[model samples]
Target chain A: MILQVAKSFILESIRNTGVFLGNLLPAFIFIICSWICTISIKSSPETLDFMIKGQFFPISIMLLVFAFAFSSATIYLADLKANNTIHLLKRTNISPAKYFLGIGLGVFLMMNFVLLLLLAGYSFIISLSISALISIILICNFVLLAIYPLCFIVAGIVKNGKVAQSLLVPIMLVFMFSITMTSLFLTINEQQPQDYYIYLIWNPMLYLSDTLQFQLNLNDHTWLPLYQYSIILTILCMVLSIFAKQIYIRQD
Target chain B: MLILDKVQKSYQNHSVLNGISSTFQYGHCYLLLGDNGAGKSTLLKCIAGDEKVDHGSIRGNEHEDVSNLVALQYQFFESYSFLKVKEVIQLFTKLIANPSNIKDLYELLDIAQYEKTLIKNTSGGQRKALSLYLAFLMSKPIVLLDEPFADLDLKKKKQLFGFLQNQVHLQNKCLIIISHEIKGLESLFDFVYIMQDGQFIEHGTTEELVEKYKNPTFSGLEAVYFEVTGQLLGGRIK
Candidate 1:
């Protein structure tokens, strides 16, 4: 039954091709802008690598946070509004755990598919090796998996697709604000002698960025181990999955 | 058989179902008829386990889930907004493992050519037919259809009702229908239940209720409903 639901959801996502393209358009525009702005610049290979490598993680974070939010918000939250498909699923014998896991995994996989396109574009522009890019993507998926269950929580709180759409912009705004503040703090601590970035200990996005940099073998602006933040995210994801299942039942 | 004892449900402070006690037997067609705001739909939702009862219990055969016995076709199911008609049908057939003559059911419902069409693009009547056809294929012991006749043309309506009546008689399933469309459908019901302001005011064989309330100048469910609820019947249920 879980597979059936997941298949149906995937099929539905395919049928709504317009939405898929709309969500993807942002990545295309960002890539086009980057290429256009860099076309006239003359730089040595060292300078180019330094520029791209330094910008890679932060740019990826911005694009990913936006892409994941827009795509998953439209895919799951809109479909979930009014407990639309759920009424049909609840009649089946599938357990709640299997049902949610199937849906979560389905959305995770599809979002990665979209993210891969963006990754390929960036990888090509930065001239990064395929192996290095794949590693970054695999680790980025851990962060993506961690955020989607929380989106389900938001879906449960909203009443319909319209509300979900409206709430999505503001939710993305919150992420943007959080990312900006963390970046500012990181910059401050690096330029100053005293390190006050410890205040960002609770910022999930900061941890995600640091984890990405650590995986890339670059120094994370904060000096946490890669495993530490991933462990924290994994625990948070499991807890959120449990809560999402409970809220899904209530919505049903 | 299915049974509900003191089924009480409320939304916030407003009680939608106040102490509804009833028993539904197998191989019978039950009609739940009521005016607007009469709680007929709420009672059906509770019985089908789609809505939780704040203070009541619903019991089916021993150790059986309510969903095992009853399947619900809600008035406005929103899932159709995304799936294709064929995908929807495939899910039902695959999950329930029920053998179905897909070609015949599709032809009978006049949806054979549109199987590949997206459900979101289907007309209202087509969606209704598809849902009813899928529900028929599942073939649960008890099927609950809330306002099944709302969006069909006359020909499709006749085909659907005839199919429903035949399914009940052939399978000996306990089929429950709740609708305000009470005119001329009294003959299709073995038992009819009436709700007035969240309470069951009257319930019995349709023949008995109509006979008891029938007058020299008036008869049928429309008049019976008028006598019971003190509101003239609207023409929409026809």
Candidate 2:
């Protein structure tokens, strides 16, 4: 039953014309930006790396947050409003734990699939090496997993898809501005060791972009260990999952 | 068999069901007559486990769980997606594990063509019929229908009443139907329960109640409803 529910949700998300367009449009924008970045630079290898490095973190955060919110939060809330199955399931033999697990698993798989496709396109165009590609994938996976549970959290609070999408707007905007500002600062100086940047240590996006940079030997970070971020992300995801269950109970 | 003991329910501070106790046996149809706020739907929801009782025990047969217990067709049945009629029937068929043929259900509702139509595009009467079809297909021993005849035309209403009569008389599913028009249903139901101010005051077999009250003017269901519930037939009982 869990697998059946999860598969149905995934299929529904993929088939929703709006969600599909939302996913495609962003990745298309990313492609356009990357192309523009490459064409406009016309500089040496170090200069190009420095320029790309500065922009990557902010752009990745914007896209990741968008992808996660649309595929995870918006679609889930729509299913809640439009489907009697959610209410029926609540009143059935299926436990709330199992039902939410199905939803979470579905969202995780979809976000991961979309992330891989986006990253694969970026790697193919940039001629990224094996290490850089692997590093980027790892970083993307971390942020995706960490932030994915939040969709359920938002879905639990929001009554419908449109409201859920609206609720995410402010949060996404703030994260986007912060990430962009951080990236702008990081790109300007090659001599400034990344360890001196105090703000990057606290940001999930920075962890991902920096992990990739370190993998490519493009930058260094001595401020914090990667395991610390992983631990924090894991704890946050679990708490969000538990909170989502409570919301389900309250809503029912 | 079904049993309720001291069941109470409230919304915010307004009490809907207050210490109500009733027992229903198999092979009987009961008309749950009440005024509009008399908590007919709330009682049904509590019975179906769709709403939790404030302070009481709803004990049923040991074998009955969420799926096999009472099946409810709410006043406004909302479908998750625009499912084809056949798909909805097939789903409850699987869930119930013992359902009549889809064609038979469709034909009985006088809506065989609707089987191919998306539920979203169907008319109100068609949707109501489909909701009835799904509930009947579930075939749970206990069926609670809230205004099943609403939105139905006169002909469709007669057809539904026919189908319901067959289910109660032949299949022996315990039914609690809430409707204001109790004239024709006097012969159809074995028992009549009247509700007023979230309480059941009088309940007995239709014959027993009518025979006990000798006056023809006062013996009919509308008379008993007005006498017990203290309101006109169409007045809100809440």
Candidate 3:
């Protein structure tokens, strides 16, 4: 059943034009837009290095948030209510926790796939800098792992998919917009991006940016540790998942 | 076998099911007949674990897992996006851990051509057929259908009832169907339960009711319903 559920997700995601568009199309546009912007700027290789170092964090963070929340919002409730899928799942021995974990895994993989595609697009258009690319991937991975538990938490509490989409929209838009704005400002005002960094320092987006900075210099190493972020988010996600499981069991 | 012992369910200050206790044995069809808002849907949902009973215990055999205990079909609200019929069937089959050929299910429901058709594009009756087919596909030992015959054409209604009867008899599966359209199926059911004022006011086999009442004036179970509940069959039932 678990494998079936996973396979169903994969098939349905690929089959549904709307879901397909929502999942992959945005990242495609983002990569294209980024490539277009870089081309229009006509930057030197040195300038490209500076831009990658300064902007990689924000861009990767935006992509991660969009992909994670998009998959979460689209699949979870629709699969449950529109098709009576959730009710059917409740009848099985498959625990809600396990089922949600499986869904999280599927969404994560899909997000990573999108990230890989975006990375390929970046390498093709811009000069491929190993450090910037690696740092971006690491940060995006962290954000995906951290936010996954919250996805199920949201899914468990929301009445249905429509409600899930409504709740997810604003948060995603805010973070995406904020990350984009901060990253653009940081990259353009490159003489000193650290001063404005305070505005988004506590932001998860800043951690990625700092990682990019670390990668660019390899000497300036004053970023929050990746292990620390992972541990915190993973624990937080587990806690939220537990709360969701309790709500689900009690709902019956 | 499924048992609900001293089940008490309420919302806010209003009670829906109060101390309702009943044991549904295996290998029989039980018809739950009641007026609107008489807790028929609530009872089935509580049994399905969609709604938690305020107080009581629902017990089944350890051998009979909860998944196999019941398959419930709600009143088709006709709300769903353009999901293909095959996708819906495959999803339910996977969830139930029951392997069902989508083609076989579609043929059984007379929706073979609807394999690739989206549910939103289907008619009311066709959607009902799809919902019923999915419920039947759960392949559980206990099947609960709420208003299974509502909005269904006479010919289709006959087909559905006949299919359900065959399931009960041949499969040895206990079928608990809740519906007002019980005239044709009343005689086929092993037991008839009438709910009124949040209680089972009358219950017995159709033949038993016929013999005990000893009146041809009460032509069928509908007459028995009007007599017991004091609500005209064709009037505002609730």
Candidate 4:
């Protein structure tokens, strides 16, 4: 049953040009930005090295995950709710849990596939071992898991797909700005100052960037151990999962 | 058989279903007639378990799960507009266990010609037909249809009525339909339920209700509806 629902969602997504383009836009933007950044960095080898060693690509990857969660996944779920697909499916005797799981799985697969392509492109710009690539993929999958519940919560709160779409741009811009600031601060302050760690503790995007840096051997200044980051993210995922379930079940 | 005992539902402070109690039996076609906001759709939603009632209970004799016994055709068919008709059918066919024959349903609904068309591109009548096709795709004991003939032409409506009548008499399925298109299709239903202000004003077999409320000014079920609810079949009294 879960697979069937997932298959249907995937089929619908591919058929809808707008949604399909939304899925690929992040990767395309990342590639274009990488190209422009590479062209400008050719003048100075030192700055080029700094850009490669810094949280540049990892932050981009993090933003990609956020883009998937905030835009495509949320809008699709909201569309399902707004257009009465969920209501129709409810009448078919399919459990809400199964329906949610199916959509989550579908979005997870599509996001990871895009991440894989983005990472594959990134590997050409900087040397990445097979193990490093796998670890990056694992980190991305973890980040997606942590953020997936937010899609449900947002969709549940929104009246329709139009509202979800309208909400996406401002939310994306805020997160993008915060994430970029955190990345720049981490790059300049490699000593991992305890005084500044307090300010960045609330930002999950920092943890994602730190985890990627740790994986890629780009920085050894992680404030918390890798296992600690996993535990924190897992806990957050659980809390959000509970809240999302409550909100979604309460809707119609 | 399905039963509703004092089923009550409300949205905010407004009561949509004010203690509706009724029994829907097998091999019978039940028609629910009401003006807008009269709880016809709400009652169907309650029966389908899409909406939780604030008071009382609804139960099916054969299964503990209400969804297992009831199949509902929603009034809105704008959902799943991204997928083709064939893909939508395939998706549901895969999700449902032991679905009815797809080819036959396509032909019955006369939607085979639009199998490759996206749902967004289909006409209103085509979408309605597609929604109906999906509702009957699964072979549940009870089927609840909300405005099944809303957007179809007169010919399509007559054909659908004939098909529904056959489904009830031959397959022994219980069909509960909510519709305002009752001019020429009165004989197809086994019972008529008139709703107003979230309650049933009257309910009986068409023949019995008409005979009891017979008048020279109006005819058939419309006359019975007029005398009982003091309103025309699909319009308010002047």
Candidate 5:
């Protein structure tokens, strides 16, 4: 039944053309748009390096927010809360764990595919050592791990699909602006002084962007220790995902 | 078979189901007829376990999971907007692990024309048929239909009741329905429960109730309300 629910999501992805476009278009557009923005600056390796450090990481985070929220939004478009699917699920004896596991798997599948797209696009457009490419992939996936659960949680909490659709753009905007602020604040703190550095550790995305900056060798020395923050953020994301799964089950 | 003991449910302060205790058996069709807002749907939801009872226990046949045994089609069910009709049908089979081929549903509902159409674009009647067809796929021991006749034209209603009759006859499932109109199904009902103000005001087998409350001039269950409860189908029933 779990596998069927998971497979059903894949089938729905294809059947709902809007879901497919909403998912694929963002990744494709983000990669192409980024490539376009960076093409003129690719003259010197330093220019490329500066752009990747200063902009690409944040852009990828923003794009990931859009993709995760949009995919979950499309899933909610089925209106499981009020609709017959949840009722059908209840009738079928599909356990909440299995149902959510299937849905979460489907969400991960699409987001991971988008990550791969961005990875391949970057590999083609930029001249990077294999190690750097691997590092960026790891970094982006970590960012995804940190963020996508929140999307699932939020999507599950919304009353219905129309409310979810109406709120998604704003939700993604808030995500983008919040993460961008974390990155920007870190940058400003780095350039000026150590006064606010300690307070900024509370932002989860700061750990993500900082580690990403560390991986790109964009920052000579990461302000927060890279390994420790990675462990913490990963643990935090796992906890959040588990919590979201619990809430989603009760909601269903 | 199913048993309910002192089932109670509420919305804030007002009660919807007040000590609904009843026993339903297999090989029977139970009709729960009531007016609008008479707690008919709420009681069905409680029986289906869609809504938790404030204080009660629902026990199905021994060694059976109640939800797995019963499939309740809510009155205003919303099908998945993103899925085409055929895809939803396919998924229903997967969920219930129905080993039977899908041809029967297609034949019964004649929804092949809308097979590829998104469920959102389908009309109210078409969606109702789809819901019933999906419920048919479950093949559970108990089938609960909350206003299953609504939004269905007479021809479609006739077809659905035919299929439902077949389910009860062949499978011996305990079929319970909450509807405003019980005209076509009156003869087939093994038991009739009339819900009023969150309680079963009257209940009996078809013959017993017909003999007690049936009007001499009228022929169908429509007049049972007037004979028993002194009201008109709760203000212009459709």
Candidate 6:
């Protein structure tokens, strides 16, 4: 049943051209920005390589994850709820857990596939070691796992797809602004800042962005080690998953 | 057979279903007739296990589980707008363990012509037809339909009435419907339930109710509804 629902979700994602393109928009924007940056830094190949690997690639992946979690996953679930598909399936004796698992599996598969493609594209522009590639994949998946549960919670609150779409821009902007601020704060400060801990603790995207920067040896001023970030993210994922299950199951 | 004993449901202290006790037997077509917000659809949801009753029990016979035995078609059918009609059918056919033959359902619902059409592009009537087809496709013994004839045209409504009747009498399936469009289709239902303010004011076979509320001013379910609720159907005057 999970596989069947996942297949149907994938088929629907493919058939819906608008959403499919929206999912790929981050990748397209990354490629175009990389092209523009490549021309400006043509004289210094090493600087260009660092820029792409250390900054562009990781930020793009973050954006991709955000897009998947909010735009694709949230709207898909909201649409199902608004259209009465969830109720219809429930009436047919399909449990909420099975349906949600199928949807989550579908989103996970599609997001990973797109991530792989982005990695493949970047490999040609810069020399990427197998270990670096693996680390990137692992970290991105961690970020996805940490962030995915929030989609269910948000979808439960915003039961209409149209409403979710309308709120997408502002929500994405807020997330981006916080992560960007954290990145700027981390880059400018050499020592661990005491006051920023409260602000920095809540934003998973900052942990994701800076951890990727640290892993690539691009930024050495990371507040925490890679393992600590992973632990924090795992905890966040668990907490969010519990809340998500409660909200989603309670939905009619 | 499905039984609801003293079923009660409420939201934020506003009672939606107030002690709705009834028995829906197999091989019979039952119509839950009421005005808007009269708990018709809520009752169906309770029976289908989509909504929990605040008080009381809803159960099928000893061998049957109410949730497992029932199939429900909601009033609005706007899901899967991106998929083609046939693809939606295929997806559900695969999800359901024992789906009825798609070919017969396609022909019965006249969905063959729209098989290639995207569901978003289909007319309201077509979507309603597709919804009806899916509800019946599950082959569940108890089928609950909420406003099955809402978006359908007169001809399509007639066709659906015939199909539902055949399912009840020939296949011995229990069919429960919530609808207010039963002027000339009185004979389609074997039993009629008149709901008012979240409670059943009267329920009986159409002939029995009409005879019980016999009046020259109105006839059929309309007469019974008027006599019981002291209001005309759709507020129409004799």
The number of the candidate with the highest lDDT is: 6
Give the alpha carbon lDDT tens digit for every residue of A37-94 in model 4: 7778777876664565464676568668887655778888888888778877865656
**Best by DockQ, which number?**
4
Candidate 4, B2-33: lDDT as tens digits:
88889999999999999999988999999998
- How much is the lDDT of residue B18 in candidate 5? 85
The lDDT for every candidate, in the order shown, is 0.69, 0.67, 0.67, 0.79, 0.69, 0.81
Model 1 chain B: worst 10 consecutive residues (lDDT sum): B229-238
Which of candidates 1 and 3 reaches a greater TM-score? 1
Tens digits of per-residue lDDT, candidate 1, A1-252, equal 667767776676666777666666655666765565457456665545444544544565555655554445544665655754666655665665676666666676666786777767776676556665665665566666667677778778777777777777777667655655556566657752114436655445656555445444455444566567678768877887788778877766
Q: If ranked by TM-score, best first, what sequence of candidates would result?
A: 4, 1, 6, 5, 3, 2
Better of 1 and 5 by TM-score: 1
Candidate 6 TM-score, true structure as reference: 0.87
CAPRI-style quality class for the chain A–B interface of candidate 2: acceptable
Per-residue alpha-carbon lDDT of candidate 6 for residues B71-190, written as tens digits (9 for 90 to 100): 888776899988899888887887777887646557766788889998989998788888888998898999999888786678777877888888999889999988778878989999
Rank by lDDT, highest first: 6, 4, 5, 1, 2, 3
- Candidate 4: clashing pairs of residues: none
The alpha-carbon lDDT assigned to residue B130 of candidate 1 equals 78
TM-score of chain B of 1: 0.89
Q: Write the per-residue lDDT of candidate 2 for residues B1-238, one digit (tens) a residue.
A: 8888899999999999989998887788988888788888899988887778889878776635533477777666556344566665654454344565545557867766778776667877777777777767665788888777777667666766777788888888888988876555567778988887799978898887776645445558777766665666767345
- Candidate 4 docking DockQ: 0.56
Q: Model 1, range B1-238, lDDT digits (tens) per residue? A: 8888898999989999999888888889998877778898888778777788999788887746676667777666457467878888877676565534545557767777788788778877678777767666665788888888776667666766677777678778888888666555667789988787799898888888888886554468777776776666543232
- Tell me how much of the true interface, by contacts, candidate 1 captures: 0.46
Q: Which residue ranges in model 5 land beyond 4 Å of their true spot? A: A1-4, A11-53, A69-78, A120-125, A146-148, A162-179, A189-204, A221-230, A248-252, B62-65, B98-102, B151-156, B234-238
Stretches of model 6 off by over 4 angstroms after superposition: A41-54, A165-177, A192-203, A220-235, B11-14, B62-65, B151-158, B214-219, B226-232
Model 3 chain B, poorest ten-residue lDDT window?
Answer: B99-108
